[model samples]
Target: MKFELLKTSNAYAARAGLIQTDHGPVETPVFMPVGTRGTVKALTNEELISASASIILGNTYHLYLRPGMDVIREGGGLHKFMNWHRPILTDSGGYQVFSLAHMRKIEGDVTTFRSHIDGSLHTLSPEKSMEIQRMLGSDIVMVFDECTPYPCDYATAKESLTRTHRWERLSREAFDATDPLWGHTQALFAIVQGSVYEDLRMESAAYLTNLDFDGYAIGGLAVGEPKAIMYELTGKVCQQLPAEKPRYLMGVGKPEDIIHSIARGVDMMDCVLPTRNARNGTLYTRRGKINIKRAEFSKDFSPLDPECPCPACQNHSKAYLHHLYKTGEITGLRLNSLHNITFFLQLVREARQSIQEGRFSKFYENFCQTYPMEEDHSAKNAASRERRRKS
Candidate 1:
């Protein structure tokens, strides 16, 4: 894979670029929909494509556990396996092993953990993680690094940063040991994990920049931090990373979060919020987010978003969606998921355009003013609240 910077905003850190991969070219400042477990939760590949998604993310940990690497390798890698002909980015599985597993031991270069899928014990080292991603045949792969939990003490954060640095060296070595199959060139990105401490964040960034990976990711944020802190930390970290290579903010959130990160110099972001929330009936619109199950939509014969050209918005009505969601029909999840992903993709597309045109600041200001988050709710509770409030 190759990245080229085409334009930059005079007002902020936002810039526009292109990532050329074997599958296709992904325009930068892009929002990649998470297709964890080989599929985007409720949407199909065609729907994702129609939403204008340039790239999609897959989980090394989940895919390895479910379909296993051998099965994917047999089918000629992830593109053929998932039937997605676009660029795919695969995480290093370090985050999942550290965060999702019941028991885990991180020692030296290897992390041993009990599988969240079953009781089987599994061990993953930097080499193993790289090998899994290689077999999966992703266009962009991440290095294995411990995602230090939020609210971690400074001492623990420092220790994990050091370990992450060490593991990064090992991951780079492992990545060098292989060549791409199917004429695909895979780029490796190093993840910087320093929790919320600026000093450690700087230290990690400085260390990794010297190592010269293809890209860098600001990890460990949006885990549980305050929104203000998340934005501040993003600004600090983006200042430290090299400007020439792509900077990705992993597991970042809402439409506003993406805009804020871009203003702070992030070039790429991925989140489960769009698809996951959509499956539960929450939808994003130009005005704001809405719950399709709300009683107010029962007789409202309006599109999900009059401005959106997605199939859901262009063809379906709020009343129809309300009935489908209330009855728990599968079509409700699919249409909502399609619309949410399309909205997110459209948002980043607009951001990229704003940056190229040297108006990112104005674009960002308008976005925040338009789509401000009034509350934080778990998907289920948010749906319930909207339904009750509308009733």
Candidate 2:
């Protein structure tokens, strides 16, 4: 993979770049929709393409546990198996094993845990993670590392960081030993884990950058930390990463969080917020997020978002969407998800344009004023975060 910086905002750390992947070029400041179990929940590949998604995320743990590697390997890797020819990024399954599985034990370099789906025992190591990702034929593979939970002490964080560094080394070696299964180039990106400690964050970034991985992902954030702390740590880490390489912020955030992270120089991010919330009848607009299930929308005839180019907004009214959701029609989920993803992609595209035009600061200011920064959504988001943790 190659990252070419095209432009940088003079007012913020925000930058616009292009990542050359084997599948295609992914524009920086990208939002990857979460496609955890091979599919992105309610949307298909054509729908994803129509929503302008250049890349999507898949979970290593989920795929490995369900269909297993043999099924994907026989299907000729994830791209062919899922019919998604665009760039795909897969996590190392480390987080899922630690967060979702029961009775997990870390012995030296290997982690043993019981499957969340069944009681079957499983083991994962850095080497094994690289091997699985290679078999899956992901365009970008993340190294296996322990994700520190919120409220962890310094000592625990330090120990996890040490193990993570060692695991990262093993991951790099394993990646070097393996080749892509589908005859396309693949890139390995390292994750920097330091919890919320500034010193540890810097140390981790420095150590990983010295290894010269294709990209760097700021992990162990947005796990429940305050928004301010996450942004502070992100800015600190991004400052240390190589300017030429892409900087990804993993498992981060709502629309506001995305805007903040972009200003902190994060090049890539993935989240289930837009999709998951869509299923629950929450819709994002330029003004703010609205719960379409609300009774007030029953008589409202306005479009979801008049300015939105998505079909949901172009063709459907708020009352109709409310009715579909209330009636539990499956089409409601699909249309809502499609609109949310479209809105997110458009937001990122607009941010890129603002950066190139040298008006990101103004754009940010105007967005904050218009969005109103709703607080009631926290309860809904918390439910999603909890599900993510358990997944």
Candidate 3:
């Protein structure tokens, strides 16, 4: 795999590039839909391709739990097992293990935890994560590093940073020691973790950049931190990373955050918001997000977004969607998901074009003004945090 820098915005740090993979070339400033457990919920591979997704993410922990590595390996790796036929980026699953498991215990270089699925004991070291991703034959593999939680004190953050850097070193060594299962280059990206602390963040970046991994990911943010702090730390760390390599911001959220990260020079991102919210009766539009189940939409027959080229918007109406969602029809989940994914993909595509045209700043401003940023998911985030807390 190789990433070629194509263009940059003169007014901001945004850049347009192309990631050349054996499967296909993924244009930079791209959003990879999350396909945890080896499938993007409610969408088929055809729907994914139709929505213009060049790549999707697979969670290492989830795949390791169900179907097992042996199954994927026997099926000739994830591409064939899932029939994605496109680039796949597998996360190390450190975040999942840390956040979703029970009986978590970090023993030196290895973390032992119970499977959130069946309460079976499992151990994941940096080396083991590399093995899982390698067996899956992912085009891009992330280093196994702990995704620290927000509101962590300096002492805890510092300790977690040290452990993360150590784990990254081990991860690099393991990745270098193995061969890609698919006979194609599998780039390994090191993640930066320091919670919300700026100094530790820069220090982590300074250390990881020297290790010279193929790429870098800004991890451990968007885990209930303030939006402003997330952007600030993202900019700070991006400044320390090698500009030529791809910079991925993990688990990042809303459309506003994506636009802001692009301006801060982030080239890749993945989030569950588009798909998850779609299943929950929420739809993204040019103006803002709207709940299809709202009473006001009961009689409204307009397109979800008249300008959207997605099939849902082109063929379905608000009233119809509302009816499906209200009746708990499965078709509503798939259509809404397809439309939301299309919107996100189109958003980044336009952002890339704007950057190439040297008008990203203008595009960002206009988008910020036009889209509503009134997401009050704090309670939801808190619930997620509580779910992941150690028992």
Best by TM-score: 3
Local accuracy of candidate 1 as per-residue lDDT tens digits, 1-391: 7789889878777889888888899998999999999999988898888789889999999999889978998989999999999999999998898786458887788888887878688889999999999999999999999997655779999888888898999999999998877568899999988988988888889999999999999999887666777889898898988888999999988888888899888899999999899988899998889888789999999888998988889999999999999998999888898899999999899999988888888998788787857564334553564576569
Candidate 1 residues lying further than 4 Å off, grouped into runs, are: 376-391
lDDT of 2 by residue, 1-391 (tens): 8899999998789999999988999998899999999999899899899888999998998899989999999999999999999999999999887686356989999999888778799999999999999999999999999998776789999999999999999999999987788999999999999998999999999999999999999999888777778889999899999999999999977888899899999999999998999999999998889999999999999999998999999999999999999999999999999999999999988998899889999998888777767453434665677787679
Across 1-391, the per-residue lDDT of candidate 3 in tens digits comes to 7889999888788999999998899999999999998999999999999989999999999999999999998999999999888999999979987786346899999999898778899999999999999999999999999987766779989998999999999999999998988777899999999988888898988998899888899999998877888889998899899988999999977888999999999999999999999999989988989999899988898899998999999998999999999999999999999999999999999999999888888999999888888755655776677776655
What are the Cα lDDT values of the candidates?
Answer: 0.88, 0.92, 0.91
Model 2: weakest 10-residue lDDT segment is 374-383
Instruction: Quote each prediction's TM-score.
Output: 0.94, 0.95, 0.96
* Order of quality (lDDT): 2, 3, 1
Instruction: Give each prediction's root-mean-square deviation over alpha carbons.
Output: 4.9, 3.1, 2.1
Model 1: which residue pairs collide? Answer: none
Pairs that collide in candidate 3 are: none
